[model samples]
Target chain A: MRNELDQQLASAASEAQAAAQTLDGSAVAPSRNEPDTAHPSASVSPQAPAEERPRHRCVELGRAVVITSGKGGVGKTTVTANLGTALADAGKRVVVVDADVGLRNLDVVMGLENRIRKHSLDVIEGHASLDEALVRDRVRKMLALLPAAQNRDKDEIAPEAMRALVAELQERFDFVLIDCPAGIEQGFRNAVAGAQEAIIVTTPEVSAVRDADRVAGLLSGAIAPKLILNRIRPQLVKRGSMLNVDDVLDILRLELIGVVPDDKDVIVATNRGAPVVDIAGSETGAAFRRIAARMLGEALPIPALSDRSPWFARMFASLPFGKRSSTRGS
Target chain B: MMDANVFVVTSGKGGVGKTTTTANIGAALAKLGKQVVLVDADIGLRNLDLVLGLEKRIVYDVVDVIEGRCQPRQALIKDKRIAGLYLLPAAQTKEKESVSESQMEHMTHALAGQFDAVLIDCPAGIEHGFRNAIAGASQAVVVTMPEVAAIRDADRILGMLGSRRARVLINRIRPEMVKSGDMLSVDDVREILGREILGIVPDDEEIIDATNRGQPVVLDGARRLGAVYSTIGRRLLGEDIPYVELPNDGLWLQLRKMMAGLR
Candidate 1:
């Protein structure tokens, strides 16, 4: 019975959501700032003027970026944090929203836990204004955050609200990146709420790649997502212990974002309450910077996550140079 | 009293009788002289107490203990009728957001050290709630109904659990429907999920009525439902219970629904 019930519900939910097309901020999302007194999950915060509903109004105030994974623990959050930080560092106002509700680790990873006295739930319920809900990062004129609710089911937050919130954030921020949760469920729904494009974060493992393939299927009806291969161990790839970048790309078939090589600095920075991007001069930090630039339509091809300088590549590079000297000596 | 042995009752999809399975399995295990704690990890929608007919007795919920609003012992709602069966009810007031993954890990770690079996009613989504329910769990029982959507979700969740390394249990099959080919067979579901099936709970109407009265179906000693739940509990205790055959109910219901819709 539940099997029948879930099948019916899943198809209906997806269809209903699809038929509605895109839920626009001004049209569909009732400026939730209105005084709502009924549902506690409704609105308890003060009202915002109609003008405050959609925050930014620049020419391209509508870019939506969703960070996703086909597999878990591939550092999707790390990419969202670092890449979003890099974008903001370049002076574009950014807001990173964690759509992984109930299991919210984004705040700690972003070092914004202390700043998250207010979260996205507060904004949705009207307990707090959007401005109050946004936790600002120090990336200067750049980044803000809408933390996931630690105490609620993300499914309870309608996709309608997600669209409205995204449109609203787009009006205010130069870029809005949704840090999607692992597993395609209500969390994924809430994460992809209003975003148009997605960036899939995957690793060299088969399981991770398989999961990304599933995510790409879901994303096909919308925008084709980009790929960021995280935690690439160059030595392992060199030793043929892991799948290389091209191997993963071949399976996923999505556009490639910058590849983030596996580095202990990522974990080190996560521990220090700053993303790898915050640590200037780190290799991952630079990669993230290039990725951010690419999102903004730059012509830079950030190298795939590889250290071909290992035996094969280094030997290959040395062959040309060594051959020139050997020929002269001979 | 909590004991060393424990297993969580969970499923990939929502409303696939997770709370129903948790309530009955917990009650059955406790009936067998083992101390049990039924912790509803469907935090915001805590209904294990309701399903077990202990709702009126719940004074504190899981969040109270986790948030330190009350002592861990205080938040535990004990059911003396079942001897060692107790329930750590989910806090209806606290949203899922407030409970951190780290906190849930610590909570389950402590429970595993104390309980014989910690039956966690995992929520519908594979968000934080599912992960929280699986933390510190030695084994998992993934309950799924014989339907395509549930099976699909179950397969996806099985893959996820595979990544995290958790066992699964298939649940709630109407033998007649499956036999009539109106629903997926146990074999079909098993093939898709590809996880160990702990039990195949028959479509027991006794469960609905029992739940209506806030009692577990297994508490009724006469019915086959009790045996089914007990068989699952015994299986959890490492007993190999043979799978029972569900009689084929010809596809009358499906034909009727289609005709009704056409009319």
Candidate 2:
């Protein structure tokens, strides 16, 4: 079983490497245990690495800090959902503030949408107070969710008011994650108004990283945006097709936080309205859990995406077929 | 915003259903009694003919017509199913650079009056081949998938289209993927691209088999995506074609599933 697992892990690594090669333009030697490297692009080369490990996940243990990416579908909600679950699992009171005004997806992702009656929109519009919108995740004892209203667009909310609401949430929770909408317009500006520290979620593709780079450029004079590369495909990197996780980090040039592999189970669980972390033994779910552990001042290293499900890509890596033509990987 | 005779099918990235889009849409237009021409512009990797499965019948390609080797009549490969629709095949042996800017200009100009709409299959890059494809085209149809890389490239392409005064076309979206937030739907791509979305083609297998056999899938009517392309072609002709936006989550999808009982 252990040998089978090892081969499976290697399989997953090569697939990730191929995906990475498409974007990163280099071959990543798979670390024996998937390297626990946050971003494959941040891995620098086979030799130089990104940061040694994640900085402390909990700043004061009691004060809540929500890190969000302003762009939608670039992995903001994933970061919020994962980080909130991670913090709560780590014994911190984490509340994810889904500030996506009209699009209430956080509760749907966290599997709490069915229970949401009064969301953050009603509270902000004076229909209800902030406390009334907080919906506790039935699975995570210490974690809570503040749903957004489904009826209004982003223009209805104010940044200062959203910030004030976040401040109040901070007094009660250890961490508050605000999932932002896509675009650098009103929605993004509003989501960032209150956070003490910001964590930007980006994929390895040039566009997502480019947007993250723009966000990082905006963040340079202010608080540094911590980087989290979600939905990185390692196999594509090996084959020189998709951008590597490290290439993204290099462009944005932000401190690397966590790397999440592209897992089919993520969709499977999310469609069932479950955050992946609840699956327990799934590779991506474990990665999210490790991310939570590291956030709580735990010493666990951020695992490289190559380690999870090594069985997926072993055959492709060993193929001597691609070494000759395609002048791409040099 | 173009006159009825010119429709250009484009995608920001290569291989995201642009050629397939051209085949289906042109076939759709041809079926509607309008004189249509599908021009292959990807100079080196010319597969539009192969994808259309009209490779064998070609006597002279676009190079022959532009380089003055043969008259446009001898080079035009007429499809049997659609009486008015014709295809101008590109040269497989030559690179994108083989055709000069003026040659591409004169080619589309010459064809403008001959057909009601000239559908140019634009090549897949930010280079010369792309320029040649758009040289004579009046309207643009930007085809794209709902994935991140496709969306990103589509945005850059949209910026280019906006500068050139062209409309956009979206293609090959999976409704289930959108509902689960795994992939963006037509709405997401349209919002991000910020261009008028011409049509949305659902991920369907018949289109693949059609591409395999080189026949236009629009004639098949077995798949809804092909029918959607036909409707898109009508919309390109300014016929006010109506297609309900396939929602990220909806009841038709549920009913479609109950009937097919897809796994």
Candidate 3:
């Protein structure tokens, strides 16, 4: 069974490599799982032995954090694109991985859709080197993307393959943010396998929260999953119709890392092939930047979002329920 | 003459009414005097059993049948309220990997041979569960809401359907929102998807109540949504039917659709 899957992935990878060569005319190594010595940067080749590479450049292993929401269309891909951009803007080497095979959206959301010549399947199946598969951001020098295959399903890559791939990526980038596909199935399992920490994204809807609660319960391992409440309409919360941050926290019982309000600019920015984080004066963009800073160990205050509420309500929200040790591990 | 007896109801995004569509369509087909069996292929996150009010009666699920713990007939749960309707529930505790594509194929083939229609409720995302669900089916019912993200996911799903007969079912459309241009209209969805729309269900609150009561909206007497699902079933059975008019389909929108059709 394993050999059949490996063979299928190998053939798919070669097809991708051929497509990439046709598109870019870059001289790619025709051999499987071998170092691309034809490239100018052979020293930095991902297939190079550890002793030949410069070890002093990476001070510490990068953090592999999986951004997942159990429910679909709840802004998991959007959060991943914006957060990775924010981290790259803060001078951190970040690689956002689209782990949603067959439904890959991270590439399009980050406007790197056309640049994907090779994908995660190619690297995992050893048809392309890790360096060959990584797509650099158009403007950001530090941010990169490891896009998923649009043709293959999630079961094509195993959890062990994903864990090893993330470990290899950790040696190069400062952060590896995996954009997990929705659902609590093999796709979810594969995305969470490589991460030491997780960021659970959810909206205030009952279905999204229910799925989030189920996912939080699933991630009961060493990783204490943090929450990023996205698309909160404060007006609905004030009207007692929608669940507020406190209500979601009460149900999820997770540490709150970021609270982003609903902004139409996010939609406009996404459809334009640019993340909201890169847009000027976007409140959602500012929220992502703050979350990135907080991820980097900054003790930024979590915004309560309900600014129109009375001062006493905001005070009570901040006392115990708002933020929970967000600055612990950097 | 087993011509496309199995249909997999799927949407790339979750909570977009895949299970609800499967249950209602199965019930509607059964009500049409056809032997219909609804298979919940979601595995670990099974909801079709609950939607059909057959949760307590599930002794053997799809996983049990595929894994050879029980025969396919032994695992089938017959609905007491509706004659000729049955359910093959998914295992609540087993992950999707417990059932492989070939196993699902054999199970679905066996079930399809005995029933007039086999409606599979596919799990969200195009992964192991999706592959397993679509393996035994000859047709797919792609469900989606009128939202941008849902439409995008549905478009992706359409791309992945690959030679399997597929149709789009737009669910949970609010006519007022479509009139006010707050939501995508049926014409907008039809244009974006560029596929044959099987049916369009209005945004109804009573469907939720009916679902909470462990009954499909098709079984509820007072809701027009049930008739829409029945119309969808008739269309699936190769009937020429006009799309149901929504509660308030504005004349201007109809004129716009007419103009678009001309173009």
Candidate 4:
């Protein structure tokens, strides 16, 4: 019975994608100066090439970072979606790649599920060119998505194929954020193959932290991975129930990139397939923006979302030797 | 003689008690006079050895057998308490890419020839490790919590299993929460997943205590926790046993029904 269902699903997924305007640039050719006919209504001025645009900070041409977590359901996709939006909102060209084949969630999270005409597997299998497979975001032209096929296995894309794909993406975007699948397997290796940096996301739990530690060890020799502690409830930490940021950092010993508080607004945003970072007044949105600033080399101070420290702690901070948590910058 | 049964226990989301279910079910089947071998297919993050309390006894692991460093039987660690139970531990220092699906299939086939039942503990995620774990098994025992995220992943895995005679085992169900409508009911989970029920195991602190001591609850001789898993084992053996009644089902359920009637 399931075989019939599986085959039906596979056949539906294998249907040919609708034709999209071929991108103006390719991996080998530097033709980004040409305006993209794809997004005729994009807000950004098509005449200004992203590479030649002036910025407050002279950001690197292309930065590829894979956001990964060893444990499943710990908000890797959420972080990738929001952080990419935040970066693109900051005037950086960002392309978020959903590298989790067969379980693609970034498209749904980013509210671009219907806009996905082609995916990374199509590029790898030679069914679509790199330019033809790209899906540009409607609201933010600077933000684009490279979705993963829903019916294929992770092993279908080899590490070399992934490296080439990421390299091609790196040429066009200022920030290439790859949404890595959970577990340190073929999917992980493929996601990390072309990336120069990694962001390990984990929740404030023993099991999630332990898995993060294992992933940290694996990534030690290649890249010094940064940490993003997600779903932290300050009330639980203040009540001595959940693990504090310091406790998690003390265990994993990785540099903290971002600490996102548990916010109900995130659920609402996700349900609508919109990124929380794009929603106004969302604490998780603010957190992702801060993380994006830090990624852009801004030494922004990470404020404690809801810190109600004791009197002595405040007094200690006033004493020159002790520093307040809010004063600490990454 | 009937064919040797090979069951791969999997959950798409981590920390959903796939390892615990694998340990308990393998021990329960072993206690039923069947020669059972539990294979830990999670290569890098191996925990079945620690869960079975056989970490010290594992001189050779599954990777070692696949890489030709040791014979298949040489890597099988015998259980101290159960006579017919064995374990093939995963290598702690290796990665998941170390073994291919064909290698895993060959190893499990060899073990099936010698054992009456072979149960594999699969890693989380539908990646290479998940593919390798299911490659060797004829049947799948998918473990999941009654949460939305876990159920969604389990549904994806069930879809991928593609008619391999799969069954769902809902673990860590809190009956009080279910009664209070704070959690999904067993019927809700069954309807959402649309799979055959192996059994439902309640949230019990005793299971945690047993796990910490490297003791499976099924071997404890206790009635509540042990019986829950052993009944699933009996069901696996093709016996028609009724599902275990949760602790609060007697009076609490009757009270709830009476309250609904009053309303």
Candidate 4 lDDT by residue in tens digits, A146-212: 9999888888989999989888777556688999987888888899998999999998754566578
Among all windows of 10 consecutive residues in model 4 chain B, the one with the lowest summed lDDT is B254-263
Candidate No. with top DockQ: 3
Better of 1 and 3 by lDDT: 3
Tell me the tens digit of each residue's lDDT in model 2 across B11-105. Answer: 64555677788888888888888888889986644667766767767789999899899999899998887688789998755666778777887
State every prediction's TM-score relative to the real structure. Answer: 0.48, 0.50, 0.72, 0.70
User: Candidate 3 on B1-263: residue-level lDDT in tens?
Assistant: 12389899999977788988999999999989999999998877676876786776879988878778888889999999989999999886788887888888888888888999999999889878888999888899999987666787899988877888999998877656566666777888899999888887766656654654467888877766787799899998778877544334464355335324523
* Quality of model 4 by C-alpha lDDT: 0.74
Please provide, for model 1 over B158-240, each residue's C-alpha lDDT reduced to its tens digit, 9 standing for 90 to 100: 66554343545556565555555555666676677666767666565455446644668777776557766787798787876
* Chain B TM-score for the candidates in order: 0.86, 0.89, 0.92, 0.91
Q: Model 3's A-chain: what TM-score? A: 0.77
Candidate rank order under lDDT: 3, 4, 1, 2
Give candidate 1's error at residue A299 in angstroms: 1.5
lDDT tens readout by residue for model 2, A38-113: 5444321223332432232222223434455423345566667877876555444567887666445677677786
Q: What is the full ranking by TM-score, best candidate first?
A: 3, 4, 2, 1
Off by over 4 Å in 2: A1-67, A304-330, B1-263
lDDT of 1 by residue, A1-330 (tens): 212211222223332223223211111222222223433332211222232322222333547899987344568777888877766554445678888765566677788887787888888878887777777764333467789886677777888988898887876555788988766666776788698888988876544554577677777887778888887777766655455676565456678877777775775676556878767578888778778767766678656544322322222223211121111110
- Report how far off residue B115 is in candidate 3 (Å): 5.1
From the highest DockQ down, the ranking of the candidates is 3, 4, 2, 1
Answer with 3 or 4, whichever has the higher DockQ: 3
Better of 1 and 4 by lDDT: 4
